[model samples]
Target chain A: MKTKLIITTGAALLFAAGVLANAQRDAIVASLASQAGVSSFNADAGRAMFLGNFTGGKEATPSCTSCHTNNPQAQGRTRVGKVIEPMAVSRNPERFTDPEKVEKWFRRNCTSVLGRECTAEEKGNFLAFMISQ
Target chain B: MKKLTTLVSAAALTVASLPALGASPWMVENNTTKSECSDCHMAYAPGFLPERSWLAIMNNLSDHFGEDASLGDAARQEISNYLVAVAPKELRGVSSIAVPLRITDLRWFRGEHGSRLRNRAENNPNIGTMSNCTGCHRGAERGFFDDD
Candidate 1:
């Protein structure tokens, strides 16, 4: 009985922690949405960003989902093996505040993923999705 | 007996140089001591690109704009060899699975090329001809385009 109780308690704690983390993510996403002047991240937009093919002529290659999984929870890396964090409202504080690096990565990754420069609206929507996380 | 052994070894060596199709180039690079086509077009998987398209991109690495990415002649040749060996038979964009996708489906990319593509008036521009993806994506490298 004692062992069972212990297991139950542990599971409860883990569940609670998960909820807390999700709440935090929600709050962060809320903040980002306001900044981008959008109310929320559209699931369709995220899907498009994640799954869309590059439309340019430079190369015939992979889509965004090729590395960073369609969702942020599905963390991925570069074809060169660089580690990428989840694109959602990252619990990792480093992601949100690093505007300079954030922009830089968006620029580089957009090219690598899309084989072209992403537009401002696309970037904004992508941010909306990440924030929605 | 020595000749037989040598023949077996040569066969193995030739097979060893082959790049895996339809897999992530990054992870593949980690396992092999050999440099791969992924080292340059770091974003797109081998299967996504037709062999000829890969060759075109690889051949022009030095002129890769956005950042003007450059590759040595040797890397170019080796990558070219790998891609040609693996290029797809069917041209892309013809079927549902065709890559370098059209704008109707890819919302993010559509928005990226939206203005220019829209300006064309008919919304009939071939996604391949617009050059929008290349303006910033910096193809021939192994990753996606970013603003940073």
Candidate 2:
């Protein structure tokens, strides 16, 4: 009986943590959507942007694929050869949890690849695609 | 007997006077600096450069190594302060042109590896670049760079 009670409490705590994580992600998504003035996000656009190559940004990193690689689930290497964690939520459960981190990386990487800050719509689409992955 | 004592003292002093082997291990760390710096590459040991180098790098985040790495003033200032505080005392006089804002550019670094490093870092598939300190120095993250 004691063991059963402990298991139930543990399950409840796990569920609570999952809900909190989802809540954080949802809040960021909502803010991005609002900023973009869009009611919905398209995951397909995000995928294209991630894989697309362009000449606008630095020649070293023409697209997200330069560092992140083609597959979101696979580990990638930085220009300096540091290993990057997989972006896919299924492979790495700890991703996209913090809004500040999400915004910060978007600001830095978008500039690296796109040569400018990513639009709110682009940010939302990127998150949507990543979550789907 | 006096000569023997003098010799012993001289030997001890000589050992103490020798230059340190590598950067001092990080005694203090800031979360912002570690996370931000390591996001793109290895969190380089702050003691690997001088205060002037750190200041220059901190000031020019926008064009960091041909990439955009700009940070807000507050975070940038905080990270710069932490790096400056831990910069190597021995390298305090190293000019920026000599080292060129890169730890690997230090004469000590160049002398340590020479031609052997270029082949391994540039050609070896397993170790792609010299900048990946953790590639060979397995204890890079903890500031223990002894194994290489």
Candidate 3:
């Protein structure tokens, strides 16, 4: 009985910690979204960055939607140019969080598509729009 | 004996400095004016971009959307080298942009981009991940929209 109680207590603590962290993240996202003024992603940003829509990643380049769809609950792109899997909030088990990763890809994708850094506000807004989804 | 000792000590110092000297030369040339390419991008996407991405960006400056944001061939190459040379490890601390989910990583991007879509929707090169491809597309650069 004592052991059972201890395990339950431990689980509760872990759960509480998780909740706290999540709450903190949501708050941050909300603030960032509010500041960015991004109502919805519309995946317009992605199309602008993709090679397809731009037809600019060289004549052979592709677009952002070339891989990841309007709904991120899907897969992303690869190095050589191929589909991988789905990663939308519902599809991909644990997604979101990590400014660094977001920054890295935004940087890479923007360059891959746009050929330049996206700007923090743009990133923040993009992020907010994403989380809202 | 004393002279030899000094010589050895000097040699040791040089060896230690080798690591620093061995680094890519661009890191040493990091100047505000040099990275001017970041004027607009500094706020858009700071240290997140890697060298490869930077190189690609600089290379595409000419047709950078419809703005003719072209760079001199040499300058473009230099910027590309610098980005890869100085970029740090990815630090994903939040989930999505708003919340740092218990897990942090652009899984949404990864999940959506399973493979490269090669089909052309009409004349436009139809891609899978539109959001991931804006920065340079004419349609997107002209208007902040990446959805297919």
Candidate 4:
């Protein structure tokens, strides 16, 4: 009975931790949405941007899908042929946990894809889409 | 009997020199360098480039090969110092013409690879680029670049 109780408690803790991590990412997205003067995030718009093609950025990588692939849940490849972890929080729970890393990628990838930094609203929407994925 | 013994000794000598052949792999094992560099690409052996090349690459993280690879100041300095220390002696103090930043751009690398490289790029999906060393050298992470 004691061993069974311990195992159940351990499983519950792991589940709670996963929920907490997700909540933390949602809080960041919500905060960014407010900063962008938006009341809600639009995952559809985010998906469009993720798949959108543009001529503004570098010719080699005109869309996020150029490197990230069309499917957020699937593994992606860098231009240098390096493997990138999947972006979907479901597929890669460790992603979006580090605020600094999250921001740095946003700053770099947004400029690479859009030729400029992403607005907070855009980031929030993007995060929403990834979370949904 | 004497000839057979000599032949065996010669074979042993050749085997001993196997690891010495080709590029010397990374000697430094800094976790910070490995995690940061390998995140985007292979944690390339620092010995591949000269100290000057490492310095140039480290200093220009924001524009690293048209990608943003900027690291925190402390982490960047640590990796730079580690790379500089472990760079091959022959590569150190070399003239600018001899110290091209890209490993593929190095004259010796071109000479060594020659036509085989082009054939691999054209035919081998895993070897889509010369930068993908591990495609052929499966033991690349351990600094082993022996032919597959």
DockQ of each: 0.02, 0.53, 0.02, 0.38
Candidate 2 off by > 4 Å: A1-8, B1-28, B88-99
lDDT of 2 by residue, A85-133 (tens): 9998778767888987898789888888888889999998998898899
Worst 10-residue lDDT window for candidate 3 chain A reads A42-51
Q: Model 1, range B63-146, lDDT digits (tens) per residue?
A: 453322444456557656655655564553445344432223444445555676546633332222333333344542444546
CA deviation > 4 Å runs, candidate 4: A1-10, B1-25, B89-97, B121-123
lDDT of 1 by residue, A21-84 (tens): 6665456556556666777566658667767777552352356676666667666754333456
TM-score for each predicted model, relative to the true structure = 0.34, 0.83, 0.40, 0.81
Q: List the residue pairs that clash in candidate 2.
A: none
**Candidate 1 wrong stretches, greater than 4 Å:** A1-43, A57-61, B1-148
lDDT, candidate 3, at B83: 54
RMSD of each: 15.2, 7.7, 16.5, 9.8
* Cα-lDDT of candidate 4: 0.79
Please give the range of 10 consecutive residues that has the lowest summed lDDT in model 1 chain A: A91-100
